[model samples]
Target: MSSSTEPLPKLFTPLTAGDIALANRIIMAPLTRNRATHGSDAPNALNVEYYRQRATAGLIISEGTQISQQGQGYIWTPGIYSPAQIEGWKGVTEAVHAEGGKIVAQIWHVGRVSHVSLQPDNRAPVAPSAIVAPTKTYLESGFTAVSQPRELAAEELPGIVADYARAAENARKAGFDGVEIHGANGYLIDQFLKDGTNQREDAYGGSIENRVRFPLAVVDAVANAIGKGRVGIRISPVSPANGISDTDPQAVFGHFVEKLGRRGLAFLHVVEGATGGPRDIAPFDYAALRRAFKGVYIANNGFDRESAIEAVESGRADAVAFGKAFIANPDLVARLERNAPLNALQAETLYGGDARGYTDYPFLTEKAA
Candidate 1:
């Protein structure tokens, strides 16, 4: 909306974080469309089309791609460590670049929030502690209850960090402009950061500094594998998504952010409220958290055009990532620029589909085409 023909909104301005550059501040949040299993459990032409259609976004963060077989939790989600998987992503990166867009792969490791069926040896998933959550995972059939996990030994901790670094290298080879470490959403890293699930007495748990140690190690690994300027990390400080809770989110995340800021990564993307839930519940000092970090801040969850503009203008956030909006309106930047109506996303076809709600969503210019 910084264009003269459009509304002069802060969301339309150009911004850069470390090595990544954006023509605008509207980002396409990572989304799981769940069509990989029909192909090779890797990216295919369908995945290419889905991201290409949304190239209008300033930055596209790919859906959580498992760092290894052990990192996988949901069926049909892509992985980044295999040669074939890296090859599969080539078309996606090429297509996005062809449209003059920038994208990054989000490397993930879903810890105990997984099922035995999704594990490497049909064994229990590993975590900082052997805790089970009320979370459910999507299978080919439908959502199933999550299985309990085996607690990871202190010796095996470095191996998990190596997987993240390997995935970062694979993302680079796949032609991704960058890679984002999935340290949020009750995954392996989040499980260690928060005190609720991380009851271990090792160096990786108990106190906030010790809790953030592993996540910070992964950050260092990925930053060393790729350039620090090309690495980003996402965190859900207060979000209860996937049954994750922090005893002291402020102290925990404050220490986490302060530590991460020193790493000089590209940016920090946060799920402001419960991931995709109400924002006003149990408020925390988000602005202080924003100021604590010296790098770019992406405010996500329940953001619309008005709120997005307000956040940027008020200097509360440098960008905003939209999930459902980007899903329904691929050219969300254009729609927001002209302040136009959007095509509502078909709730049924959000995942595991051909192209109905995927690439077939019409742009504003194509409404009558």
Candidate 2:
């Protein structure tokens, strides 16, 4: 179908990414729910129900799943490193697929945005440099400042890249349709991408080329592990989330996106504005960045229905991803189709909880009744 003839309210529009055809363009952005089973860090039945409820999205990107024990920064977050964890994720993927939906796993590593209490053996978090994250990570016990992270040796970079590669392989084993590298939100990849966090003088730091090396390596590794068509990456060029800031946001991210475009990945998901708190401001123009990256662009961050439609209609983005809106509206696609009002998300139950604010959110039909 031609882009012009595609119906505006057709939330189920088909989109083709290399080899895979999506049932719609409404991609579910990866969101951290922090509801994994304690100690086990495995996905539970509630997690399954949570994802299954939102299966109407053309594609569902699972929350940031840790690649290893050391990759976790928050309490009760799920991991893909263990057999039980893989089994747990299998249920989520199977449930989504059972409803004729496609899903991808967003593999993530928190880097220095971690507290000692959340680290393995209560050890320091790891990053390209010894700089501590300027933000705080939330825990059940409350929020705490991030501890100073140990600088990873150059030799250790390969292992970390392998961790992401292995996680992509594991996602395939878990029966996911694809994998999304969480290179955004000041995570491990973002820490390396931004200049403020990466103070190393080695090949991984100093110039923009050097700073983007680790993230590029990760992209190449994961793309190699899974075919390039099955791999995607998420980036926030001007994000200040987790105290991440780059010297020249436009030049650095423009080059980074240009380089990434050459790899022929499935799509590039760009989150505009501050991902976490209000501190990290957007310094670069998003439209300019969209022009630089010559691929399927999924624009995210604080977008409403009108703006989302305008983004697509204006050619600014191929699609728009919703976070909070989808959290409280399982039939989000239907609401958009009917131009109905969305349920406002309750601030209290965003993370670390059960079905109260999760699967219990009534659909538009139920609300009308």
Compute the lDDT for candidate 2. 0.85
**Which runs in model 2 stand beyond 4 Å of their true positions?**
1-6, 9-12, 276-283
Name the candidate that leads on lDDT: 1
Write the residue-wise lDDT of candidate 2 on 275-354 in tens digits: 74342365567777677666678888878778887777778888778888889999898888777888888989987878
- The estimated TM-scores of all candidates read 0.97, 0.95
Candidate 1 residue spans exceeding 4 A from truth = 1-7
Against the true structure, candidate 2 reaches a TM-score of: 0.95
lDDT of 1 at 274: 85
lDDT of each: 0.89, 0.85
Residue pairs in candidate 1 whose N, alpha carbon or C atoms collide under 3 angstroms: none
**Deviation from native of the Cα of residue 86 in model 1, angstroms:** 0.4
